[model samples]
Target chain A: MSNAGLDSAYDVAAVRQDFPILDKPLPGGMPLVYLDNGATVQKPRSVIEKLVECYENYNANVHRGIHSLGDQVTTELEAAREKVRALLGADEVEEILFTSGTTMSINLVANAWGRKFLRAGDELLLNEMEHHANLVPWQQIAHERGAKLRFIPLTADGRLDLTALDDVLTDRTKLVAVTAMSNVLGTINPIGEIAARAHARGALVLVDAAQSVPHGLVNVNDPRVDFFAFSGHKVYGPTGIGVLYGRRKILEAMDPFLCGGNMIRRVRKESSDFAELPSKFEAGTIPIAQAIGLGAAIDYVQGLGFEAIAAHEHQLTARAFDQLQQIPGLQIVGPGLAHRGSIVSFTVEGVHPHDMAELLDRKGVAVRAGHHCTMPLHEWLGVTATTRASFALYNTHAEIDALCEAIQYARQVFRRK
Target chain B: MSDDLYDDYILDHYESPYHRGHLEQPTIAHEDDNPLCGDRVHLELLVDEHDRIKEAWFDGHGCAISQASASILMKDIEGKTLDELRDFQAKQMLDLLKVRLTAARQKCGLLSFKVLKTMVYTLDERKGAMSPTQGGRG
Candidate 1:
């Protein structure tokens, strides 16, 4: 059933219609083939409309106002929380905490939880495949709390070397920080297997699902994820809104991140108590409309179904892999298509990644070129940068052809000189 | 004014860069990177007793624009005085490219020039540090 790929019933043309910006032309009347989905997906019309509707109708401060507008805004905001809870399959809605983005979400856990729980000799196990967002926060917390940072290492193909895990996951290991999928490598990690092993050794697991959640289903309870962080903008939603799903019991034990008005239960001149579950972590005025828009984005994705989206995206990825390979001097980084998601990052023999991106842009194909915020991963790959062509439901096979053509043109331009 | 940023001029410099390596006994050397894009440049200059740049070489790993900028700028500074090279502005290095750059791409084009400016001024900075003023080379 997990292999329910290439769903003939999945009509991608209809899906493209939902995202209006997909049809827009570039400056020279060339169609815009946006392949930067790994960074951020294009929002559906429903999400766009929901943002306007929030400001147009129920625009008020949540959880503090006495007016009807406040009631409506508060209700919508909580409703969005419920949707996020459902999306990640958390046991309770309050287990979900609203954050600015994945960076902040991970920082919340590192500071609030790590500072309290981690001992001096404790180790936080990480791997080379993790984004800077995942690695840097742990580095900071580990240094602050006098804990050690250990690496699990990666296989030659860029998958986590689980065989090396037994040696690394020791009794002193406090946490295993990993990404659900590599934003640069496109490798989908085995979170369930990693989590089970971590638990056996008394280490908690935190999954950075910024790349995974948008492309596939992630049930927090199934693998029994202790902490999961993801950005809303990456999942066809608005920017400035993200989710941090920690187990309710774990959340209750941790200190509140970003303290002030909303997160407090009672305030005195000297000391004060923090509020309960969700509110305790949420400080300051939240990104009100973005949360609501994220709810709509969740609804829009759920309406299409993960099975269908996966099937469609799988077809695109497989096709892109086959096509991108035939090009003479181009080598796609990461594992084979079976081990990866819809992202395809590659490097040409002579053409640099930045130069490749510029030439692709000339042909109206928008691709990301850089280390994709995984500098360590690039270091491991022995390259400075790679051009990434990441896909979504709206991307077509024809767009893949356009990508190949532009790449060929780029090769010619660099090869001749 | 060219339609393409990586034209023959830029690509030629990138593909077959002139004076692209380290010197055996360089008088001055410096290196830096564009943290945003991971582009990097390392420059080595041999200065003669006349206080002129007798020869210059650059080694870098980056896009066509940045690396070509290194090659082009190094070629221009081969026989120039140390003060003349020091007086060289970012606009002159940019004009050497003969291509229009966006704000972001401007950083790529001028990265080598930045290294050159830093290299030429390191002596003055070191001297200033020795003098010990309220403000040294910030």
Candidate 2:
């Protein structure tokens, strides 16, 4: 594929056109000013049409069917896996396992690897800012395996207290699970540094890239990274399909997570053997069309290049900070713009997040409001909830202005008597 | 998508709620939250010898709709019999707000109703009258 972004100037209008939903007028006639990218991004036309194409043609079960359509579907399926493997810079396609989403991917490791290795006193290092997807699975597995959960304290600014890494990364720490970017705080963590520290203590690192992978470049082959997980929907791909890249040696040694028809290598009435690296985990007829759509999404993101995506998103984040902070009572949470991604979570002095979100929605700007699945982080921030306006490559500076305007409107409505 | 969602009437109740503080020596009380958005409601009622509401007060933090719902609920429940309070429905609360709400926002509008329902139900159970206390939820 050609370097589409490298060869030309980054055009927001062109990027917006690629995603049909971005320009569409809402039912009330206002233009859609979608800033909920941190939750699930708007899909480009290519990914949408690719899903339609996959369903229209070669609509058959993969791997088992001897018919022509079956072979075609199987080829497309494996090709999609290969695309994901390459996207993550893994050593082989076999190392990439397609699950339902990042939640399922993390659960697989927690069950397959965690259940096998965790002893009663063994510790799992996590942080307060982690999304529920990263925090919950480890909590479940730790509870089941009689393991202890240790949190890496956050600095008052909401960034992880890396200075205290030595305090938590002890020999008993079996796994260090963390999000590459704070979904609530927008803090970009130093994953490579964290991994190095954890590895020194013989603990494996699992990167929850659900928020990070979609906005920037990520290579699972980073030697310090033992496993990486992300959802396709968050990256402008179809929902119900996600990726889990595990170290080859680690995956080969662990027992399978799910058991069923397509995941077996051979079966006897009394005994059965499991399939290979990916098939061992993919039990039923997988999300065939969604996986292919995810491939298209990878191609779409690759064509845009992460450098352009990051630069554009940083501009949006900066605009939001400059304008949002200027709002009399608004306090932006998480780290400052220099240390974050495109996400900006904040709370107005007088308005609640739910009210803020509703008022913003009235202006056709869709932002998420709540604890954002990080109750601990919200508690640490000493607020019940915060309004988040997360950006993507297709977002414009005008959208940031609209967000600020909506906040002003909300403030006026909630101003003291 | 209309600013009318939080218009003058709703904002009026939100800014200067009629019963926005705690009540002392309340006969019935309950506290609950909308886990979906962390919106909470604490409703307290002081009842007379004949099971009629003498006073109603509320304490909580949340969106305008929920807070306003409680503020108005305090007005509607005063001097109301426990039976009448039990008969109060989620739709009535929305109707009182004078605003259109989607299903999700309806939860915010009904948060006070939820706390009030629980408080009344617990009272009914104590009185051996557990016949589905509150009307249909929003």
Candidate 3:
């Protein structure tokens, strides 16, 4: 229960207490079984409280507000920016720009970065496992710019096939946009090495860390990634808040994605220049409460410590993989790497993923089914869909056991008919 | 919490479903999916020479509400004509769910019925003898 103890060890019961919504009841007299953390995690009381406190105590506009309440809110906003900067290990707070989650963040890069530099006959490298957020924007940009879009193929084990990197990373390669960890397969890519390769080719690297940040450690400084984007909601924070971290020098050199009030340095009727590194990217009125809540969520995560969380989730994932293997015909996807965080996706013979999810739901066990927004990967693996059980800090071995039993029950139920 | 929303009979059929596979000479076949959740159901209709649904078979994979709704629908319009099947309303699907479905789950519950109706409408377009091989799903 102590903070020091929590920072070093795995304690599910203690961690579960932090999330009040997890104890709520459902319609069928079932306790809430939230295994859809990959979509959006349940926020802790700390995050909720921080949001409420910000709204009640310091409700005012940030940056341009000169009044008392505005000053208070602006100070809190800057503090939140600092927290995000530390979370990502960026050089300074100016590098972290708040956006309305990953979609907007990606769009900002596509509009500002893609629109400016990429040209016709140039190529942008992408992997098969990218979420639609990462793929579509780049594709649209490529279509407009008349640039060629190339794919870095996936391996049989579901990891990015870097063997073809030599071919993929051509001199004309403008950018390499890839996911650090796939939301569907939970496979962690070698972002550091991939960034190095792309950088050697004079191409920038944009990492989709939406799935990776919540599960394990992420240090943009260590990886030396050019641009990193992730959503707060996926990491136990409130929705409508995300971060876009660009290297300081790179951000300063790039044009503003949006031209508006706060992001402007000085506005004459005729002409104006944009603000510094982050404010230049963040144009409109920001999600103040959500940003403060995300700051709290980051603090909560750091307090729990990534090493301990990883160790705990590692144990639970190993147990889940082993238990699922014991089942007769279930096939676990991805590399089964022990270092990867606890995201297990699989399928059982003769049982459709949706049917399996339903049976599991009946047993008060929750699991996500279907393509998980990575349809191309599913197509590559020759499965229409798969059931995914993604674990969080509060998830327990007991939950994995329950999931296994429910899946077995599903097999038996379908088999009987 | 309405009994009409999640009837025990519906849940019973979901847990121990009936007529859950391909039918012999299925007159009409339909498949539908929830793009968000990836839930899907396939409805197979066995119609007689009189253009009446003589037998109704439901198959494919989905959640309890969707599968049960499909089962309950098969039971409701088993002996009805295409007109009666088409006349089937959203309220009937809600009544079959045995509990009020949210806006999202409501679509999951109604998709099978919609797809089946579409299939029946499409079937009327064929001029020649409808081959049994044509009855097979995509």
What does the interface RMSD come to for each candidate? 0.7, 0.9, 3.9
What stretches of model 1 exceed 4 Å from their correct place? Answer: A1-7, B1-3, B125-138
- In candidate 2, list every pair of residues with a backbone clash: none
Residue A416, model 1: lDDT of 35
Interface RMSD of 1: 0.7
Which is superior by DockQ, 1 or 3? 1
lDDT of 1 by residue, A283-395 (tens): 99989999999999999989989887888888889989999999998899999988999999999988899989989999999999999989989999999999999999788
The C-alpha lDDT values of all candidates are 0.90, 0.88, 0.82
RMSD of each: 3.1, 4.1, 5.6
Q: What residue runs in model 2 are displaced by over 4 Å at the alpha carbon?
A: A1-8, B1-3, B129-138
- Docking quality of model 1: it rates as high
**lDDT digits (tens) for residues B1-138 of candidate 2:** 343787888888988999888777999888889887988989889989899999999989988888888998899889989899788888887788888988888888898888888888888776664344543332
Single out the weakest 10-residue window by summed lDDT for candidate 1 chain A: A1-10
Compared with the true structure, what per-residue lDDT tens digits does model 2 show for residues A1-417? Answer: 122333223777777889887777999899888999999999999999998998898889989999999999889989999999888899888889999999999999999999888999999999999988888988999999899999999998889999998898899999999999999999999898999899889999999999999887588756459999999999989999999999888998889888998889999999899998788889988899999999999999989898888887887788788988878878999888888999999988878998888888888989999999999888889999999999987888878888888888888878732
lDDT of 1 at A228: 96
